[model samples]
Target: MAYRATMQEQMIRKGPWLEEEDERLAAFVTLMGERRWDSLARASGLRRSGKSCRLRWLNYLRPDLKHGQISDEEEQIILQLHERWGNKWSKIARRLPGRTDNEIKNYWRTHLRKKVQEQEQEILQRAINNAVNPQDFLLQQGDRSCEDDKSRTSSDILQISDYGFAASPYEDRLFDWISGSSSGINEDVRKHNEVWNMFSSSSYNLGFVSASGDSIWDYNSSSSSWNLDEDLQVVKQTWNTQ
Candidate 1:
């Protein structure tokens, strides 16, 4: 016949304490009164180790223990202390009257650390949204300026004629030079200029002109578009009566 092990000869318990163990431990603590843990378990008839008993007392069973969510004031103190001590949790815990180093460390990792990570992610996303695309942004501004110029009156068109050729002879010469030059201008720039000249000349009479009279039109040639009303495109024909 195999002999069953008695409770005294059983393997020492590890992990979660039972209600009976808690009751026995509490009773032992009430009589033996604190610390001296190595002998406390053996004397109390608990199947727990001294370290386990010490931890349970310090973390859960202490009379002054505050049980609930850590307050904001406690969280701030923990952060400040952690900065100074750098994971010296015991040192940090001392500042908080009832909190243990283990509890503070758990709070930092679970709640405070996660909150910081979320805030950092939000900041990074915002920065990406606000960030400018240098090439595209400059082109957008340039296109907007061109749109403003396209709304010019007839007087503005006449003013452009006066300023474009008369004020600067080199302006006409530049075009002539570009057209006839052996070294070709950039094809996109050439096309943009061609579009501008078509609008400005008396032959077309679009009656719209640029204020700056600056040449080099800004547009996305790939998405080149026109919003002209057909009535606005009327040609001026010279009449001869004999």
Candidate 2:
């Protein structure tokens, strides 16, 4: 019995099935029905194993098996189900009529696996792009605010220039004095002070010069001191003449 079993094992074929073997297995399965695969293999008189016979019949020889290319609708279904179940090809195959688990598994390995990985990577990249860091956002806002302030300051300087104040040191000093000291002064007094300060600034050459080129009113002379009443009288005379 042992020698006979060894002989049977030695006679059993392993590898690709021939067309004659396939026909013989199909005939035996039809005659004996699809149970007791070991008995069916022996009865079929084909040197292939019961497991091999069963796999070949179910995957290839079955009349209901679909040999055509997977359709677009079926591909979409496979992708969705794979996302939900993950690697359960047999479970996935049950939902797709006429598709074997082995066929589905091979398709996934060769084609769909890479597609799914690329989709996941694309989704990850998009999420990274949309997620802005809070610190970076604040820095951008701060930079924009600083730019706005610089633009506003430039516009103010331009406006001042348009009004005939050229933003010199003399003008800055005059502006400081007016802002600091002229708040409580009457309008007439403030105007008088403005005129006085303009004359006091060294940059202004408004004083009358004699023929010898000496200033008649040397307001620019540091050593010269004049009474406010006298200065006011001079200013009044000059204004009335103008």
Candidate 3:
């Protein structure tokens, strides 16, 4: 028990620090320029470790530190930079001025990471839901698109095929509707292409069965036509026959 007591006596202070301790830490950092934390802690007359003193100075006592909650812009930057660099908090902190690596790491752990995880879970659930009942999901999206027409620009809204066929028969029809020379087809084509690009880049299988049995999305120069009505009519007639 004597060895344990000696160890305890030698142990540096931990947990919440005092106001005077904060000042001494800050003063030591100001004078010493923060290069040597152990020396700074000794000089400051604090029973705290070098690591603790350094963290307090960098995260709290620093004059250039930004107080208050992170703004939407900062949050967005953090999310994007984290996506690119993974858990390299210091690298991410460089992009966000007045923010410490420790602060960013804490913020990500407490808030942003959970939000991202929840979003991923939601997307996974949607994918599963889509797999189980694709027609229902498409119809729901179609209905929502129609209902929210006034809120979105022409290009921002999800476009469904006007042809009132079931999901299996309407896959190619939807592609044609986007690519064709209909009044709003150009905007629809742009949005559809964006979705297609996202899916392709992510390698997400959307399970789009081609009604034509050739290719549903043939946007190549030779295959693309402003007028695909004749082919659509043939598809319609074939669907009617079946």
Candidate 4:
């Protein structure tokens, strides 16, 4: 029959820091300097350790600190820099104006870790799919012979110039589709937005065939996709009306 503990070990405090505490810490650090952190903490009337005082001063109390949500471009730059230098946040922070090393380091842990995990999961899923569909990997083109003439005509019409998804899994199929379209699907990009949207990832850009035989229609949006003949008809009617 042991009784419940009389009190919790520690009380949890949240919300914005108080103004008096901020002012006291700021004034003490400014007047006393870094080496005498213990003395400064006691003089300033803040019940914190020397190490905690130093961290708070550099990480939060500093004048040039950037706070709140990081923008997309900032995120991209951080990722690229991190790959180049690994976990050297201080080195990375020097390149980013108005940012701090600790802030950047925390952001990497919170955001970059999740992105890297997602990429790894996507790769793992691809590996699983390839393993399950063993035959799909070996077969380059499903209907190569039946499409020879059609492919040739599509090549003639689309004026297909350059393609980037050349090494894509669907290289042969994409080439065949372009060749068969008589409408000139001369898509000259490795990443075809139209076809790429159908699957998680695509190497082909089979968006459309331009009249000039040098352009291809692309599917670049979430709301639209290709339906071949029927959709093509609807598109033509809509285009004419517009």
Per-residue CA lDDT of model 2 for 69-181, tens digit only, reads: 88765676577657645777876675566788999888899989999889767666655576855434434544464454342333333332233322233333433443344
Cα TM-score of candidate 4: 0.43
TM-score for candidate 3, residues paired by index: 0.50
Q: Where does the lowest 10-residue lDDT sum fall in candidate 2?
A: 202-211
Question: Which pairs clash (backbone N, Cα, C closer than 3 Å) in model 3?
Answer: none
The clash number for model 3 is 0
**Top-scoring candidate (TM-score):** 2
Distance from true position, residue 73, model 4, in Å?
2.0
Better of 1 and 4 by TM-score: 1
Better of 1 and 2 by lDDT: 2
Tell me, what's the RMSD of every candidate?
Answer: 31.2, 38.8, 17.6, 19.6
lDDT of 3 by residue, 1-242 (tens): 99996785587898997999998887778788978888887777798889999888888888978888987667876786576457889866754557899889999999999999997677668968668554455456554645633433322222212211222223345445433533442354343444334332211222222234433343211254423566456544643464
Runs with alpha carbons beyond 4 Å of true place in candidate 3: 1-11, 132-242
TM match of model 1 to true structure? 0.45
* TM-score on alpha carbons, each prediction: 0.45, 0.52, 0.50, 0.43
- Which 10-residue span in candidate 3 carries the lowest summed lDDT? 156-165
- Evaluated at residue 112, the lDDT of candidate 1 is 83
Sort by TM-score, best first. Answer: 2, 3, 1, 4
